[model samples]
Target: MGADGGTASALEQALSTYLAHLRVERGLSANTLAAYRRDLERYLAHLVASGRRRAEDVTAEDLSAFVTNLRTGDDGGRPLSPASTARSVAAVRGFHRFCSAEDGTPDPAVDLRGPSQARRLPKAISTSEVERLLDASSIGDGAVPLRDRALLELLYSTGARISEAVNLSVDDVDLEVGAVRLLGKGSKERVVPVGSFARRAVDAYLVRARPELAARGRGTPRIFLNTRGAPLSRQSAWAVLRVAAERAGLPHEISPHTLRHSFATHLLAGGADVRVVQELLGHASVTTTQIYTLVTPDTLREVYASAHPRAHD
Candidate 1:
């Protein structure tokens, strides 16, 4: 017999080992592990309630059925979206893969196909809208005006995520070189070049607004501060964008992410390669960055429909 004895016994042992691996070796966050645990628990409960006791007894059809049930099951008879169903399917698949590899059983979940989810395109604002938003930041005079201008300019210039921008420190920005070092998802760092407009706005903020704000907290290294000298929070950054959008006569719902989308779309329109934008955006996969290409194609269609003779019916 192996370390855990029979195949059934080994299945339980393997699950424990896998969970430990996720916690220790992978260093998955508590919330993530909790989510995994919840997903697996629901899946196993479904399997048990359906009279499937052994992990080895699960077939691809059974797994697929579970996904289907998840999609259609509801307390009040409401159906789940393809996206929500996919996440549940992913969780079950992961559990079965662990079972198969560590317990020497076939991975039935591998053959079970997930639900097809419609690809939701990223919403990118037009360049004219972006220009209007930036212009709105400059309407107010004095320190807050400089701060708002710098905040909006930097956001569009770097295409940094809202979190990355607000979390920045003074040391992360080099105005002379027009580069800001961003700490992206998974704590990975990359340096992105800023535009002249952003650089000038930042310089003004540092020389004027920052000093005033920093006085409230002795001295903080954060690039952006509120009335207090402490660094700006993500919530505050979002508010700044919303206020600026309102002032610009744009929709009140415009967010910091809208500026990011605009930045990517505009860059692609100006002939920058998608791969380059992927690196600048700190996306791990080029596929994630390819969504911006859709924006370009859409713009081309609009241009063709509008400008070409005989294009419109």
Candidate 2:
């Protein structure tokens, strides 16, 4: 009953339409779009194999079975970890929801639930380690070092995600007011105060280093530039963090998000309210910011021991 002579072809057509919507309307990034494609392709293949040709034909039980298969790998592939399973479930659910909205079909994944995953605490570097990392960013006397230092300093100061940091324009940061405007996920913008240290570093880069770097290529307003004066890519930003971490003699692997986690954790440890940190981090919900509170359990224990009379006993 389809172009390719099977219901599977119809399902594939539906998937193509949904992916286009995500790309054009939702404005999902390429990496996110690819991930959704992989998850949903696998899911649709399972549905087709089970004779689910139409979205209206699928049931909630079928969605539940797919989740079980993902967890147990009963279909013969390697079993998915809890986190991967959750992501796949999310992709599949979103696909079904899109189909329902477009054609008014019953959403099979409406009540679907993902596996219970243990919440892992975000990894954060110590204050001393952060200092060392920042110092390492400015190891040499050159434009590159100056730019690297400013980039790292801003990352730690405002808790900007690596993408947001690299994508920043010159006008996004105001040294006079010591504030930086960050465009977050879904293009939501938030203004966060820049610390004195970061402002000084960025100031030095803007005044002394950026002019030289900006001369090599055509021209752009992006704050950070490579040697060719082009906007710095996310991979380049990641390489800067890796090189700095190695120079600082840090043992564990560190990513740009490590700085963000450190910023939130340090703020929470210093008695900053969770809501304020949420605003600084540009999180849509305070609930997302609450995870940083768990990182300071030792600090809480110390306070309880010092303040509560019966804490020691």
Candidate 3:
């Protein structure tokens, strides 16, 4: 009930209950929960090392030490980057808050602050550039071209990560309903609406291409396949996309997340709700999707500078 109730076993039990709360009440995905667990593991290690065994026994000084430990390194010479340290500190903070709220344990991490993270704005391709990429992918006429075209279109349209696109099965796509089910990180599955362009491309690939590829691969259920007929690996998908990007004259350094980034940015620029984009992008937190909003202001400024009759040069 208080700091007087101090035991290492009590701390472990409290950590388990807090994690269960995160999973059930909070609906956090598995990967996110794993990260929380990983971060807390370090914090727990720090607690154990300092001989503070109970949630109530943790103090502001202990929380600060945990943050410092995260910044320095964990028994290893390798240092954690600022962002990684920040995430770890955040996990520790959340754990303390959970203990305080649920078990009425004192909250020592309440005033602790994680290191400031450098904001890495997502890079978004212009709409015209995306169009060029799609056109280039579909330009060549062959089974591979057809499949690549579908893949690229789907990526752009649905904002699916490459893994989601590759893991898709024939049944995951509902062309008639204009939707595609994406299996995202943490085993989360989301069904995003497919635009007409993506549907048409997918239809062409399915009708004229997928069967041929599948035949070679012993009836693999994956929607995208390599030349040898196996389910497309992330590496191969990246290579396929690189070829399309080169043909479209896109930058050589363009990442696979480009289309996904562009999708969210464009939607936000077009006045889409942040919450809607969060659902589309399969983000567990709306705050995660809020990054795209940062990309919209430049676009808004461009619109204002170019349009409005009074702003003549």
Candidate 4:
């Protein structure tokens, strides 16, 4: 109610109510609600530090100022990205709208417009680069090599988020059927098909590598395990990806999501239906998967520029 109660507390209460609305009324997924919480928390922190403590007390001027600060201020002295700032503004605007309807309060963010951000396309690795990474993982001829090969193959084959791939259980993978059950964002379950290469790599790891690792501790159902037989963590997965990329002589800045992007891009380029790709990627909306169409257009333009008879002057 007051500044001394802390802006965080007030915001937290408001967010809890809003999140409930999102879950029960709007039927939003848990992952989406979690993102909203994170965004609102950052906005509340910014407001509190600037002396605007209460949601009911927020003015259009205060909201605008917060947007300006997000665009320009150093977050802990490091520059904030324009894209991140835009997402923050969107989160704030959504919160204000929700608050207005639920709490019957004046919405200060009604007129708040997000800053224009550059539309950068998702980065995708070439099919050849992916093959090279997978091959490089198998060079060492040991349990680590088998594990690395399986992990890389699964990532590219399934287009799974790194978190989902690392969190897989042995029962989730069906080697005979060449399918894997992935727990995606919001704990949504989707069965994604795996390629033969990935299936063979996983089979090798299960038969040879996993048993050796599992011996270090009590047996668990986790598909991927560390050297100590524990489930693989997200950080370790990332490190493994980076190491494989480096060994394959790929770019140093590549991330695990690059495989995901490549998966979608390649599928779209090969005439896979948008809805089918959406199901494979576990996207709740087709709009989220439409970004790949932009990539397709770019690819067409490149092809036309190179091959059209009248294009070369």
Local accuracy of candidate 2 as per-residue lDDT tens digits, 1-313: 2433567788888899999999888877788899999888788877877888777789878888889999898866568999999999999989889999999977888889899999999999999999999999899888999999999999999999999999999999999999999988767789999999999999999999999999998999999999998999999999999999999999877987999999999998987889999999988899999998999998878877888999876
- The prediction achieving the highest TM-score against the true structure is 2
CA shift at 38, candidate 1, in angstroms? 5.9
Q: Of 2 and 3, which scores higher on TM-score? A: 2
For model 4, how does the per-residue alpha-carbon lDDT over 178-214 read when each residue is reduced to its tens digit?
Answer: 9999988666799999999999999999999999988
User: Ten-residue segment with the worst summed lDDT in candidate 1?
Assistant: 1-10
- Reference-based TM-score, model 2: 0.90
Judging by TM-score, tell me the better candidate of 2 and 4: 2
Candidate 3 segments exceeding 4 Å error: 1-30, 74-77, 135-142, 183-191, 218-221, 227-230, 246-249, 271-276, 283-290, 302-313
Cα displacement (angstroms), candidate 4, residue 125, comes to 1.4
Clashes of 3: 0
lDDT of each: 0.80, 0.91, 0.85, 0.83
After superposition, candidate 2 runs with Cα above 4 Å error: 1-6, 20-27, 72-78, 301-313
* Quality of model 1 by C-alpha lDDT: 0.80
List pairs with backbone clashes in candidate 2. none
Writing each residue's lDDT as its tens digit, candidate 1 over 1-313 gives: 1232354344455456767777787676565678777666566656555556568788777786677777877322246688877777887777888777767989888877678877776777778888899888878666778888899899999999988898899999999989999988656789999999999999999998888888887677788998867888889888888888888888546866888888998998777888999999999999999988887886667767887999977
